[model samples]
Target: MAAPMKFHSLADKIVRTRVSSTLNKDVKQFGKKHLFDGDEETCWNSDQGSPQWIILEFSESLSVSQLDIQFQGGFVGKSCWVEAVKSGEESFARIHSFFPQDINQTQVFPLPDTDSTLTSLKIVFDSSTDFFGRITIYKLDVLGAS
Candidate 1:
């Protein structure tokens, strides 16, 4: 039998971020095929701002090694921050942050260690605003070590 593949956490991995105006229609449509209900829209407006935040929840613990985030640039602004947190027994804490100067720019974030496990990821604007315009994510890649 084939040996069980060992996975490693995302320590010392390089993450590349990309900028886009919309989530790839193929991915969105593909995700919907597995879901029972609800539609996923690329552009959204939150009470806080025009740029909408994308929150990701994983079914199992992921030994995150790297991350790639794509932000959509609209009329609202040109820069934003990305954060990651490990889901804990009681609460969540910040693990990684990324700031991109322009839309369509790719930023690489390196992991500090491979021992970290991540359960959730969040993307939001730098500050709380009334609205953020049309934030788009093209892809999110998580490198694992184990």
Candidate 2:
């Protein structure tokens, strides 16, 4: 008999580690927690600036295979890069890069499979909308196995 498959989301099982970033203090409602709460209406918005980022750390290594993200309209990540740190690694290494379109929709990115597992993931925003430079993320899902 074939066993049914199980799925897990690293975003949903994030470690207690705090997320750090430079965000607009005024937009308190749109905080980091909103990014992984599985709500499409809520989002995380950063302050108008360059080099904004958010890092998610997990308690253990995760065999991540895909990453899904939703960005807010008008306030999107124009130039961004994704990085991951494998278990036992002290630093993160670049994994992917792309220019997110200015629209309200979810984007799925397939990550290359690796023999090792990752302990942390980082997303860096080098630039954003022409007017605000703010980065608004509606949702983030990290799909993988333990």
Candidate 3:
């Protein structure tokens, strides 16, 4: 078996965040906050269908170096991309794109070392596996420095 990848976060900072789609109100306990709650069992599940997203806004610009994501089995995002808006930019620029395997695991991807001042980060889920086309994210972590 292959060993999993590991990364030491550059900065342990948390920021204000929001999601594009959340599960129905019926599952009140399962909200977007679960993405950063440090619990593997707790997750933020999209209502239904694809094209869901999550946005993280920071009080100050950060020089992000990497990102780590954990997705739930079956409900994993089949295709996704990451975008960022610099301190003064009104629009987001594509930073990274990925196609994750259909499994429950943590995957870390290295970001460009451009040293840009990023004020916001957006993760877009273009599609998901079967099961109502919902995307379930267990955790999302951004690593970098201010």
Q: Write the per-residue lDDT of candidate 2 for residues 1-146, one digit (tens) a residue.
A: 97754556776567853344536574468788788888777888777777778888887788887778898888777888888898888899998787777878788777777678888888887888857677888888888853
Q: After superposition, how far is residue 37 of candidate 3 from its true place, in Å?
A: 0.9
| Winner by lDDT | 3
Clash statistics: count for each candidate: 20, 0, 0
Ranking by TM-score: 3, 2, 1
Instruction: Write the number of the candidate with greater lDDT, choosing between 2 and 3.
Output: 3
What are the models' TM-scores? 0.49, 0.84, 0.85
Highest TM-score: give the candidate number: 3
Off by over 4 Å in 3: 1-12
Q: Measured by TM-score, how close is model 1 to the native structure?
A: 0.49
Provide the clash count, candidate 2.
0
Q: Residue-wise lDDT of candidate 3 within 16-81, one digit each (tens)?
A: 778877778534676888887898778888889778888888877778877788888788888888
The whole-model C-alpha lDDT of candidate 3 against the native structure comes to: 0.79
Identify the runs in model 1 with alpha carbons over 4 angstroms from their true place.
1-51, 73-88, 127-133
